[model samples]
Target: MTTFDLIIIGGGPAGYVGAIRAGQLGMKTAVIEKASMGGMCLNWGCIPSKAFIESAKLFKKVADAKSFGIDGIDKKALKFNWKKAAQRKDRIVMRLVKGVEYLMKKNGVEVINGEAKILDKEHVQVGETKYTCDKMLIATGSRPLRVEYKGIDQSKIMEIDGFFALEEKPECVLVDGGRINACEMALMLRYTGSKVTMVTESDSLIPFLDEEIRKFVMDKIKKAGITVYTKSEITKDAEDGVYVGDNFVECDVILNAKRRRAVLPEMGDLELEMNGHFLKINEYMQTSVPNVYAAGDVTKQFFAQVASAQARTAVNHMNDIKETLDYDKLPVNIYTDPEIAYVGFTEEQLKQKGIDYKVGKFPLSVNGKAMIEGETEGFVKVLSETKYGEVMGVHIVAADATDMIAEAVMAMRLESTVDELARVVHAHPTTSETFMEASYVAADRPVHI
Candidate 1:
């Protein structure tokens, strides 16, 4: 038996990242992954999706070339080579996957290619061979979910992997589900001139979004010419269209972009407590069984960054560091056209928690830089506790909102107050300056609106 100090199952962000950390701690670590080293986030999901988004944005931009002082362009007959973009997406995914492999080698973590079957908390079997470890981490991640709607043709369906694999654009697309992946696909394809419609089983699209942000996103979706139907299901199907609550919608493709379920490892009888679909973990990332830990999608921390953070925390605990990850301090981001990034409590969450909070907001329309960019369609909203001025949440809807959110995350992590945020010097004529401007509003002082 090949024995080691740590054996990580699943080489996604969580497993590979944790393996590197464990190697740094001088533990003999090996990672077992059935597929590519970087897992779905790199091979199929986040990286490829973003690549397509950038291309889609470029196509949209080219269509509005006259606004940029570039004339002699036909907007209706504008040409976009989607196959070239798809090729670029493949290249990007390959580059990142290889980079991760290099990192594993540099960190002295052995990369094993095989499915890990849990023999016990301390041993895992891959094929006919068994490997033993002093500590085990189950980071099996999740599989792309496949939902079969009633009266839907199976041939029209495409999952995330299939959507990215397409070299040509479809004429019309019906995106099933209402969560992150669905929203991303709908936007990415629609920007490339596909007639898109979003159908969800929920009451509203992205229901967890802050009410203001949700409204902003919905308005954008509508303006992009993508139709949405919430609380609707596919009832019957015809040759070309499916009935969505008495309305017939035609589509060349039906994207099954539902929320993926956690890929529970084959753990015969070695029981681990599960919370709904994800493996239950403690503050230290320890599973119910000692010396066994779980992280990433398997534990349902779907964000790639969060998965990596949780993985490091698990490794830290194994080395007696006693460090725990504070998920509350991390930003939850959605990559819409103008983007949506937020950290901490939403207004709804604050009200539900009964916390006394005050709000300060600055629209992009008032921002000098946003006006300069000609992409001024969002806002920066700040929330602070009334008594101590402690920052409760910061929400942004702008082009670079995802990047802007980390500052808010750091502020909350360091326990900074809204007054401090307002007092800080921000470079002029930048969207980030809105953070300070919004803080000024929260502090009862007016700046640039």
Candidate 2:
């Protein structure tokens, strides 16, 4: 029996960060990971998907060179070596994995390479070895959910996780989710010359986002030549296509972007509280079992771009440096062509909660930088308290909106008023000026239309 002061199961963003913090606090720690050090986000989900998206963007740029006054651009003659693209993504994943391993060594945390199962509250079994610790953290994360339609098997259909195995692009692909992944992939694949169709149960894409932004994204997706079907469900899987209600859509590949659930198969032996399979954690991220903590997608927290934010909160809780996690200021991003980044509540949410709020909106067509960049497509919406003028929420959809929303997030987190943001001087002819304009509009003053 091996013993340590702290033991972490699943070497992911949450587990690795927790282990490092525990080591910094002078506790001996060991982290057990069944697969790679960086887990799904690094190995399969986030990093790899971004790399491919970037490639798709670059390919689109070259394909559209003629629009930039550059003639004799033959996009059909251009070819992509998908094997190289896969290798490029693999290299990035490998580097990040090595970096995680290096951090563990620097923090003097031991690494165990095997699947872990909790024997008791503080004891974990890995293969033939059993280890005990004073405290344990589980950050196993989540896996993509596969819908069990007739003839849809592990062999024919591919979920988001398995979609990365392809060395070549499919001729036609069907994306079966209406949210971020589905919308993004539908646009990217269609732009990259694959006949793509997006099917969703909802009437509009990305239903969680603001209604205005959802409509804008849907229009852009349509303009990209991707067929969009709404309020439809896939009933059966045929040889090369899926039957949605009465119509069968033809496609060579199917991408499932349905809801995901926490991957906690080994938790059956542990005496922990669970809402279905998701581990239930308190405000301090402590599970039902004493000294056992769970974070990231394993917990009941909402899944989005706020994953790292939640991981940081969980790290503080695990280290006992913070008494509670403040989840009020989480920022969410949808990585579409005109990305949507939002922090705090939506107008509908505020209305439902009976919170009186004022809204300010600035369209991208009026922004000088957007017009110059030729990517004018979305808008920035700011919501504030009706009486006090304090910033309640900031939502943006535009080019580099993911990067630009940080300032708004900071302002909202600091409880800054709309007047404060409006008064601040932003650089000339920039997308950031849109924030300033929106803030001004929130105050019922407009400089530029």
Each candidate's root-mean-square deviation in Å? 1.3, 2.0
- What digit string (tens of lDDT, one per residue) describes model 1 on residues 1-449? 99999999999899999999999999999999998988888888888888989888878878777887888998878777889998999899889999999999999999989888998888899999999999999888887675766667878878766677776888898988888778878898888878999999887778888898888777888888999998997777777868888999998888877778799779976899989878999998899998999999988889999999999999999999998777778889887888889999899999999999999999999889988877798999999999999999999999889999989999999988989999999998799999999999999996876
RMSD of 2: 2.0
Regions of model 2 farther than 4 Å from truth? 152-154, 302-305
User: Which lDDT values do the candidates have, in the order given?
Assistant: 0.88, 0.82
Segments in model 1 whose C-alpha atoms lie over 4 Å from true places: none
The best candidate in terms of TM-score? 1
The TM-scores, one per candidate, come to 0.97, 0.94
Q: Tens-digit lDDT track for model 2 on 168-213?
A: 8887988989987788778767766789888899999989887777
- Deviation (Å) of 309 in candidate 2: 3.7
The positional error of residue 159 in candidate 2, measured at the CA in angstroms, is 1.2
Top lDDT prediction, candidate number: 1
